[model samples]
Target: MIYIVLSIFCSVTVAMLLKLAKRYQISIIQAVTINYLTVIVLSLLFFKPDFKVINSSAPWPIYIVLSVLLPTIFLFLAASVKHLGIVKTDIAQRLSLFIPILAAYFIFKEDFNQLKFIGLGIAFLAIILTFLRKTEAQSKSNKWLYPIMVFIGFGVIDILFKQIALHKELPYTTSLFVVFCLSFLVSIIIVATMVIRKKTKIQLVNVGCGLILGVFNFGNILFYLKAHKALASNPSTVFASMNLGVIVVGTLIGIIVFKEKLSKLNYLGIALAVCAVILITLSQLNAV
Candidate 1:
């Protein structure tokens, strides 16, 4: 439970940090690039990942895909927080679990119980209502695209990570290190390209922001793994708590601290999102 709580905190904190980045004039791309560097260092220090086990036959395609996707989605994550606020962005991210669940049904051909079908129905409604802007002017700006991209980007990334998990020959931690290192390289290419184009500048503040963001980002992953380890017998509990906890915590912080406004329908959407997660969890437990 402690690990789950900590993991939730770390997850929301990443969004909060991105919210703060703009106020401090931090460059998200640079910070994200540096964030990958921070993860690599921590992975080496903590996981002590053995490189010798990696071979040519390893799932390099998945590794390369994730390497590109991780940092790219992170930028969209920042944009989503910047434009849509943490409330919608966090919900979109958590709801992305449905993507893998959908894959289970279609690609993996896992049977879904009635509870899951109901949950998916409500989740779709939640997404529509959650992103509804109160004003026509706000709606016209199309900033909603950020969270939409977040939804798809994270969904795809989730699918890829699950694919990586399927390859048992490589340890998850080693695979993590390799992906992070490659992501770092990919981020460098992006940052370098932007630098050459003079679209953004490198600064010490971005590095500092990245350092903090990396700690929280890595903490989210670390504590999530720890929570799973601690509750190996009740995997469903960790999954439920982690997702529901983020939505609940992120909602409160976004509204209370940031004073983010929400329409009544939006509030309804959030409530429905909670229900959707509960139903989905119940569905999974029944399957077990």
Candidate 2:
């Protein structure tokens, strides 16, 4: 339970850091690039993944896809937080579980129950309602594209991660390290290009910010994995708590600290999103 709480805190803190990035004049690309590098160093020290298992038979295609998508979507996450605020951004991200759930039904042909369908319906509605702005000016200037992309990008990334997990030949940690290495390489290329073009300059503040982001980002993953391990018998508990926890924490921080405003419909949407998660959890438990 403590692990779950820590994971939730770290997840939301990532958003908080991104939200503060613009005010601090931190380069998203530079910070993100260093973030991946930080993760690489941490993975090496902690996981110590065996490289021998990573042979030609490994899932390079999925690894390559995730390598590109991870950093790209990370940039979009910053944009979404900047425009849409933490409340809507976090809800959209958490609700992205629906994407893989849909894939399970349509692509993987997994059994789908009525409760799951109902949850999906409400989740979609919640997404619509949560994104609604109060005024005309706010609506017009709202960067809806960024949050929308975050939703879809994260969903696709989830699918890809699941695919990599299915490849049993490679241990999950090793596969993770490989993917991180590739992602770091990709981030470096982008950062290098921007530097060469004189579009951005490397700065110590960005590096410092990136290192902190990396710790929390990696902490989120580490603790979530630990929670799952600790509660191995109750996978749904982890799923429900993780999704719901982030939404609840992110909402509080967004509203109280950041002073992000929401309409009545937005509140309604948030309520529905919570309901959707509970319904989805119940459906999964029933399935099991």
Score each candidate by Cα lDDT.
0.93, 0.94
Per-residue C-alpha lDDT of model 2 across residues 178-212, encoded as one tens digit per residue: 99899999999999999999999999999999999
Model 1 lDDT tens row, 136-210: 899898788888888888998999988988888888999999999999999999999999999998899999999
How high is each candidate's TM-score?
0.98, 0.98
lDDT of 1: 0.93
- The weakest ten consecutive residues by lDDT in model 2 span 133-142
